[model samples]
Target: MIKRRLNVLLIEDHFIEIMKFKKTVSFAEIQHSITEAKDGAEAFKILEDKSRMPDLILLDLNMPKMSGVEFLSILKNSEELRHIPTVILTTSDNQKDLEECYRLGISGYILKPLKYKDYATKIEAVLNYWSLNELKKY
Candidate 1:
């Protein structure tokens, strides 16, 4: 368990996927506050408010408004927001997507697991690791 509660921004389009992620996180036993965004545009709007800035961002590659890559480009270029750790949490196994995300300065890229159990396990590990890792908050 984390010593402190983390504020996480989850940008995903699919409602079912969002719910699954929330469920998985809940079972992980990690203390966190998750703010959901349907798309990158909404996520960016939330980020505009410095007080609401998230400790981490879980981004999906495909979405209706402003894809994940576009969001990452903007976030990485921003002096104020660049320090926040952004991880790609998507179903896309595209090699190009992986390379582009890394090039754009993503902290990590993870392929979404197919099974619910696997998803929960992967999320638990990720949350545990991040909770231990040091981050530079802006």
Candidate 2:
């Protein structure tokens, strides 16, 4: 099977987490391009460009400006952006958060592992799945 290079939008606040994700992708030798957003507001700005719409969005729950659930609500409500696959990549393992995300139509919900190796494995699996799966072009 041909591996598609994904355009991933990572909405994360922590600098270290962003760096770690980039490192993991590099270590895994994945060719996907990543776009970083410090918060949900920044993410909206990035998403405004229809020509550069991401194939997948990896969102973190705790953010300064706008929370992940809030962002997800707005995203899912939009007719134009609703079809883009969004997955919650957060440390929050709260049952309510998981239920809410699923209700908001998130493609997946993943809890961030404490160990680096586990985190890398999960990230790799998520990326691999999305890269191989059929995605709608905007």
Candidate 3:
């Protein structure tokens, strides 16, 4: 069976983090089309335009302009955009941040692993789980 290619929107501020994420995904062998945004503001702009909207979103917590929680608040409130699933992919293991993300209805929260191989494994697990899950019509 052929694996499905995912359209992923990645909101990350750090270039190095983005590079790690890409490398992990590649190592996992997950076929995906990723759209990168430097911060929550940029990601929100992309979300506003329906044509550029993604199948899923992986957000970073602490970002310039707007935070991940701020973006999630708007995203969950929007009737046109609420159906899309979003997960928190961040280095922050802060309890408050985790609680806030859960309260805002994030699909999952993953703390970034320090090891590259471990990171790739976690990413692969996420991809596998989501691939088997069904999405609602947007």
Candidate 4:
């Protein structure tokens, strides 16, 4: 069954890959409006706009200007941004990365090297879980 994609925020330095993956793999399969950010700095800026706060944040590590760790550190301390669930979906499969993300209170962590099909599956799962929780709070 085709699913409506939720509004997703993807924070990656490489915009092309994000766009191509979104289009080619069909995050739009679930009909998601994927908002793109070039780096952690840009992502933070977008978060400031109350109307643009994303339901799920897909963050990448090892970015230029502002790294994902730096952003996570900042975010966890901010009451305004802390409630937004940010997932570390990055190439750093290192244990340290995973540990740090959990310590910073990330909602989830995903390593790279994931198959294209699996990537879509994970994305779909995140959307579903978020939707369920949102409904539960009502």
Tell me the whole-model lDDT of each prediction, alpha carbons only.
0.88, 0.94, 0.84, 0.76
What TM-score goes with each of the models?
0.94, 0.97, 0.91, 0.83
lDDT of 2 at 113: 94
lDDT of 2 by residue, 47-70 (tens): 999988999999999999899999
Residues 1-138 of candidate 3: C-alpha lDDT, one tens digit per residue: 346667789999999899988887776556788899998778878877777678889888889999889999998998888778899999899999999889988999999889988887888888777766665534
Candidate with maximal TM-score:
2
Q: Report the C-alpha lDDT of model 1 over 34-131, residue by residue, as the tens digit.
A: 99999988998999898888988889999997999999999999999988999999999999999999999999998898998888888877777777
Per-candidate Cα RMSD to the true structure, in Å, reads 1.4, 0.8, 1.6, 3.1
Residue 78 of candidate 1: its Cα lDDT? 94
Instruction: Give the C-alpha lDDT of model 4.
Output: 0.76
The positional error of residue 5 in candidate 2, measured at the CA in angstroms, is 0.1
> What are the clash counts of all predictions, listed in order?
0, 0, 0, 4
Show where candidate 4 strays beyond 4 Å: 1-5, 24-29, 135-138
Q: Relative to the unseen true structure, what is the C-alpha lDDT of residue 20 in candidate 3, on a scale of 0 to 100?
A: 88
Write the candidate numbers in order of decreasing lDDT.
Answer: 2, 1, 3, 4
* Candidate 1, RMSD to the unseen true structure: 1.4
What does candidate 1 score on TM?
Answer: 0.94
